[model samples]
Target: MAEHKIYTMSVAKVYPHYVTKAEKKGRTKAEVDEIIRWLTGYSQEGLEAQLEEQKDFETFFAEAPRLNPSRSLIKGVICGVRVEDIEEPIMQEIRYLDKLIDELAKGKAMEKILRK
Candidate 1:
């Protein structure tokens, strides 16, 4: 059987796209920053450094100071796959971010989106 490799996507590439999606729905860069920091435990400075470095998603998540425990509570379908049902831990974490972005774009309150 031929082995297949998963192509890792770049967080730096998608980060601005996410911000644009959120801003179009009346969100702000600050709010997107808040979400990223809340989930990844990165300070504003650290987050900015990562963005400036243009890191890949794997590296970005790998370097996160800490992943929020409450992130597991995030439940929903993204791209036809349920976030909670994702088998790969890393992929699940990525989907959690996607779900949060979806909520932010849909105008869910920041408090709720942050799972506070």
Candidate 2:
């Protein structure tokens, strides 16, 4: 019987910002490629070491920052999430909605509540 060895591959994805930023700074395509290679290699090595040390699958697959300038912002949801960038009124509105939901769930309020 022959023993088999399995190895997991690590993939590093670079954001579009790297290329755009490099071009805007007047770096040639070849230079940009080299930079990308160096960054990806360093990131991969660091991540692999972290994974080995932590031995946690979720931590190993953590999201890395995108290199592109025009990339969309990352977003996530949580049960009691608060965002600092939004206006106070918006936050208050969310709080009110949450309260309304709780009230309805507990059979406390059946009337429609309108927010101005």
Candidate 3:
């Protein structure tokens, strides 16, 4: 059997990278944060607190205040794996965020991006 490694990367470490990628494509960090809020239901303050504390992705999602139910409607292949094909709920949530970031970077409008 293949060995499975643990996930320990902090969201704070990755957040700036996401911001930079989106900014390179003309998207703003606020826009990225907005989509993150939409997915995780973290208030701006709550999200910032998580970043300030250097929370891991596992804890970030596990501790999300509210996960938007509409996020499940997002379906597509990301990184060669179908978003809907992910069997784990937390993994699904993470992929949902990734998909939203991709859409944001692609210039999709906030309303449509939020699936509103």
TM-score of each: 0.92, 0.22, 0.92
Q: Per-residue CA lDDT of candidate 1, range 1-116, in tens?
A: 33212216667788898899999999998999999999999999999998888877777888999999999889999989999998876777788898999899999999999888
**Residue 41 CA displacement from its true place in model 1, Å:** 0.3
Query: The CA-based lDDT of model 1 is what?
Result: 0.87
Clash count of each predicted structure: 0, 2, 0
Which sections of candidate 2 miss by over 4 Å? 1-87, 112-116
lDDT of 3 at 5: 24
lDDT (10s digit) by residue, model 3, range 1-116: 33222235778888998899899999999999999998999999999999999987778989999998999889888889999998876667778888889988888889999999
Worst 10 residues of 1 by lDDT: 1-10
**Model 1 pairs in collision:** none
**What Cα-based lDDT does every candidate model obtain?**
0.87, 0.33, 0.86
Candidate 2 structure quality by residue, lDDT tens digits, 1-116: 32211112222222234344445655444443333223223264564455356423222233322232211121222246532233343233233333433333333323321111
